[model samples]
Target chain A: TLLENPEGLKMGGERRKITILTSDLRGFTALSERLPPEEVVKILNFYLGYMADTITAYQGTIDEFMGDGILVLFGAPTVREDDPRRAIACAIAMQQAMTPVNEKMEEWGLPLLEMGIGINTGEVVVGNIGSEKRTKYGIVGSQVNLTYRIEGYTIGGQILVSETTLQAAGDEIKINGQKEVSPKGVKKPITIYDIGGIGGEYNLFLETNEEEFVVLPEPLP
Target chain B: TLLENPEGLKMGGERRKITILTSDLRGFTALSERLPPEEVVKILNFYLGYMADTITAYQGTIDEFMGDGILVLFGAPTVREDDPRRAIACAIAMQQAMTPVNEKMEEWGLPLLEMGIGINTGEVVVGNIGSEKRTKYGIVGSQVNLTYRIEGYTIGGQILVSETTLQAAGDEIKINGQKEVSPKGVKKPITIYDIGGIGGEYNLFLETNEEEFVVLPEPLP
Candidate 1:
């Protein structure tokens, strides 16, 4: 996209609504502790590489890869009414993509990796940002914090979305459950929904069963 | 260094004693919420760029920059007897460097950034790791987990080191406070010390005053 339209990027910023997606690998530290670093990196690469492909296909701009966590933004460079719907659809695809990733892990005699994705839709400032020496296309706002808080509540193989995301996604969004809770530093209690699937044009769902996180055995002496 | 000593690189893994230094910017989320993303990046770049110079000067290899956190390795590619001492000295220098970084922040009408460093010395596997498509020189061991646990104990402008680091750095390392706490999943309770300074050929100290971290105000509507 940068190749096609270098001039499309605005220098400063304006308030816009964007959907944020954060996915983190469950038991990554366990994998690192028990396996060789080579094995750990290979497993991480397989999972990350596949998710990267899926994220791009969904028109979500990959923001940052923080260790085993992938942060993605949709409707940042350009805002569209369909962004909320697409973000949920993209998340469903990423979850399904994990099947092949875990297959490789199983082949390598490693524990299956489960991913948890958190999504939120809200207004934030997104644009080109930094000093003259270094610049980055980024987003910043209180929404970013809320999204992380929402992500923290998710179990492996689960997709959780904020109340704002539920509203933005409208009636087409399918939900399995909803919980009302107050996150630290938030002004009011908000409802976060466990997403089952989204219907209409993009019909997708996961045949997922979340299990209690099994802690890996402590490293051998 | 890689150009001069390409043959020094080893392919596989071996147990080697290395000093791991992890530094994270305190209140980074607060800064991002209040200021523009550009300002946040500017502040981050200033701190990271300066630390990169000091880390390189001290022969510490930067492993990765995760958001506002910088992960570094000493005695990884090559094991050195003085790695522990150099790591402490480097921590002191990095803390001192924060004064100038804060000055720039004050100049820009932004809040000062405090940094907490965690240092640990232990045996970890260090070598090139990954699949054929992508490779990374990395380390994996329980020590990595222990170091993060120690870092959790530090306040802003403070340096904390595990007991192994205290033993490795020997008698020249001066400390301010020590606490015995059992981190989760650890078999034995270990003492983590707050570092004040280090003495020897590389005499370096930070005139740092550790303070309770003041939480940033909630973002305006």
Candidate 2:
């Protein structure tokens, strides 16, 4: 029984809209290929576990992990009136938290890693789902897609966010406006911005490795 | 830049686990052949709008909407300790909700719509994806693949889920333990179950639609 019910379409009382942040690891394929499967799994566990912990530390929910990545949602399951601000804060914390994580990866003699994060805010339909057999809780909307688009813009070690997110985040976040680019399926070109750093002191533009490139994108086809 | 950075896998994080549901209109190809493009789009919109509305109400994220179907995720952008149960509950709701939706379609002289939903739950990597220029939020993994496999079992108005999901849903869900079926790429046969009606209202086995028949999967080469 996995079809829609009429009554269920009515919104659940008390649910509020919020911001979503979807983050993925950079260079994971190559890294996974470099290590054995077990090692790859181990490395992923170590890194992802740490990131989830950090995100949750800021009262964010680790919605789901899709392998080498995490879908982190703010002001959901638990709503914070300042969810936009909280999302920006979480992005900052995530960037800062990666330092020690990268250090550990280096210590393990594994290749150091980088990540890209995308954030968006909008009204989304949120609820529980699954069949008569299982159910899950999540959010849905073009906002989710927009968040993914922002993340897609991130190179390793960079945080990308949409203009809506930037406005919602307010002065709490430090961001440098990037270029406007069109994403597939979406008609309008979305402006991408770099999370310069968060909490004022932490800088996301730092390069941990000597050869880190400022831009991690491939040449256009 | 759009082809470079992917989310979640680059940095370490906890294992992101959740359920994925892939549902498509059954006999859509035949339906398409019989209908004009505009009418088809209209019908699809009506049907998908209903489905999408119900899915969002249940807290499930409508991750992507293709031509005639939607891919939904439970436990993303938000998660509960009881996500599996939530997913199953949502599935039941979906089936239960279909009655009135179909009635509306019939009123519009649109053919009754049927869907096949496959649900599977397990760990995956979720995150923001894309390259240096753009990014999007999404999920990836074998769990995602397995969920699609479960969807393949259904013909029309059927729900198929992996055993893992059943166990997770526990006593809340009632299933008719369909015989284990072999799916491609996996060594062991996946234990599947036919869904009975949800909330004790309907049973899948009792239904006898003259049009219903076993969906013959493509022959293996």
Candidate 3:
């Protein structure tokens, strides 16, 4: 059902404020190498099915699937005032959904898979992006690329958000930590926040904060 | 045109021995962050245009464009005996074409852009990848993911190939150096060859070879 939307195939493009989220399965390449092709597909399908369901439930659009990576967009063709909030919530849900997905993998004798998510909110050109014969609804802009760079910094099970998303998402979202990263191609170092969860149901694991409390012995008395 | 072919949209997929080439434009994100949206699109179009031309010239298919990255395939739709060689040769040509591309960027008062290419040869599932409403010809497998991991190790202007690709490409392709990288997901360390050029016309700059010459000084007595 994710790829069955007929309205997404219409021609032309437009510029709008949208939130883009990119998620990549960590260590999938190595895991797939050791397994049979059908098994790999089965495992990937099991993982991606949960992701797709969660994303669609939040009204997010599945732009495309890049093998073990996925590109998703919010606030395209349909816009909501809380698109950024929805994007963050959807990401949180996806992260939590991995529990059952991995459980299924365990039953199938497949290794557990981890995912890193990066979300950014900005203006982008969204529409059907190919020629007359074939085209798919997609969003493109520097923000999309930025989301990718931000995602590259994340490890397994971490959700990272750009400053713009943090600002727009309001104060309800908790921050586990923040990183000032100068990713390749950006002139300035942008601060990215590690999202802890929204509301009371989810728990926050501050993995990046361990180094901050490192205590050195009193100056070699 | 690259996106105009109707034959690439059929349903179902096939497993074939195709050469996958993944290239990413280095620092384009930082560069785009400093420029206007229109200007960023202009520069990207300029760079990707040259890459498309070279790939088409080599009879390769432009599978998909991942923002600043590209996933190309050879021996798809139609297979060729020299698909591996064509991939390597196309990579070399793409590296060579950067000079002109940089010149245009310089003329436009923009900084130079660098690209890293990774080529791999193996069996992958290639064919229409999505539902019938919207399907694109693409390749997916461990080899495809391995190509991405291999490309991750490359710097700007460098071409890295897997052992499989190097073996199938024959001796006409010159190697600058080789590295044993244990990329995540792979159980064992794999050797990746840094390709310098193809044929006698191109030069091989052994950037990876410099470290091998480290000489230990005489032990202090």
Candidate 4:
């Protein structure tokens, strides 16, 4: 479960650098309107089950499940040197996992689901929050909210990463496109990269500061 | 508490047409980053307390609190003929209440806070969600998500309302400006009205299918 409290973890919050990932289903509200409540639960269960498995597999911590959206943290309760790379790899795997999940949806005669994911690496206060009666082990920071805004800019099946994340992940992840966006409340425009894949033999493009791009073929003989 | 369930409310879900209001404190996450955890909690408590009081004063139900954001429902557990109008009035009151809140923040030597509110009226599935051990009396629907999207377009101290809300509010409220927005997942462009005040003397503009506008003076003297 996303709310699990690991043993020996401090109840007091700690500030740490972590990569936060937020993903939400596209058109889910519209889709849910047409289905019965029980059906909505089934779809959410199947979808979240697959996603939770993928996150755990990558050693990422599931933060909270907000209706059809999921907020996840990488490098919490424990830190990994390759957390950024792990986050990107985990995102790709989740995208790949969507295929089977969609296949099941088709069998059930339900509308196919698409997701938009946003990842950002930054410092956040993470640990138990709230009063004694009701406490939640979660993360809070501007980066957490930025991850949501970045996810907002995406459509179905798109994974967007902030410049900080791209720099941390290095050349291991390939990029399909890039854009600068000024999300509300943020002081300045941020450069975001549309992730393609992890070290794939795909065509890459080089762009000049003037916005001109040259396509470069990979694995050229 | 936003999650409080009043007496006699059903644990089972029900369908109802309620006005949903979502508001978020602009730039709060950035401001919190510079403050300590205890200070952050203090600010949230102060802000949310004022908001919760305003919502309850107007007979609205607080659904959930999302970090710096709050989702509220009016016409739930009971229906009111003037729920939409009450919601708009409540939003205006909240904006007005911000002045005192900001004053207090200034006295505390903290950054002043601004909020953006979005209201939408539509049918939603409401009642207990989750297992018996952990059920929440909340709302679910596309309209709930649309309210969030509408809130996204607002800056600080702005209240944006959907067409449904406008229709329900009728001539009881005055609007200062209007714009058409195509929120993500929404099929087409929607005309959103920027609310000015309730039953106030203000200039209003009328638009036609061709996007032609005619300005009319307040009270049509």
Per-candidate local distance difference test: 0.76, 0.66, 0.76, 0.77
DockQ of 1: 0.11
Distance from true location, Cα of A110 in model 2, Å = 1.7
Per-model chain A TM? 0.86, 0.82, 0.85, 0.85
Q: What is the interface RMSD of candidate 1, in Å?
A: 8.6
Q: Write the per-residue lDDT of candidate 2 for residues A1-221, one digit (tens) a residue.
A: 12344334332322346788888778675455445545565565666666766786778887666657678778778887777777777777777778877877787788888888888887565455323333345554456766776788788777777777778765646665588989855778878787765554333343345446476689889
Q: For model 3, how does the per-residue alpha-carbon lDDT over B1-221 read when each residue is reduced to its tens digit?
A: 11132223334455679899999887765665566655655555566667777788889888887656788898998999989988898898888778888888787888899999999999886555433333456566788878999999999989999999999986677778899999876789999998877774344333344556879899999
Which pairs of residues collide in candidate 1?
A: none
Chain A TM-score of candidate 3 vs. true chain A = 0.85
Model 2 segments more than 4 A misplaced: A1-15, A199-221, B1-221
In terms of lDDT, model 2 sits at 0.66
Error of 4 at B94 (Å): 3.1
Candidate 2, A179: how far from true, in Å? 1.6
Instruction: State in Å the error of residue A214, model 1.
Output: 26
lDDT of 2 at A94: 79
User: Per-residue CA lDDT of candidate 2, range B93-132, in tens?
Assistant: 6765577668877877888877788889887655553223
Q: TM-score of every model? A: 0.77, 0.52, 0.67, 0.68
Report residue B134 deviation for candidate 4 (angstroms). Answer: 7.6
Among the numbered candidates, top DockQ falls to 1
Model 4: lDDT equals 0.77
| Per-residue lDDT over A124-199 for candidate 4, one digit per residue giving the tens place of the 0 to 100 score | 8775643232345656688888899999998888889999998998565778899999997699899998987886
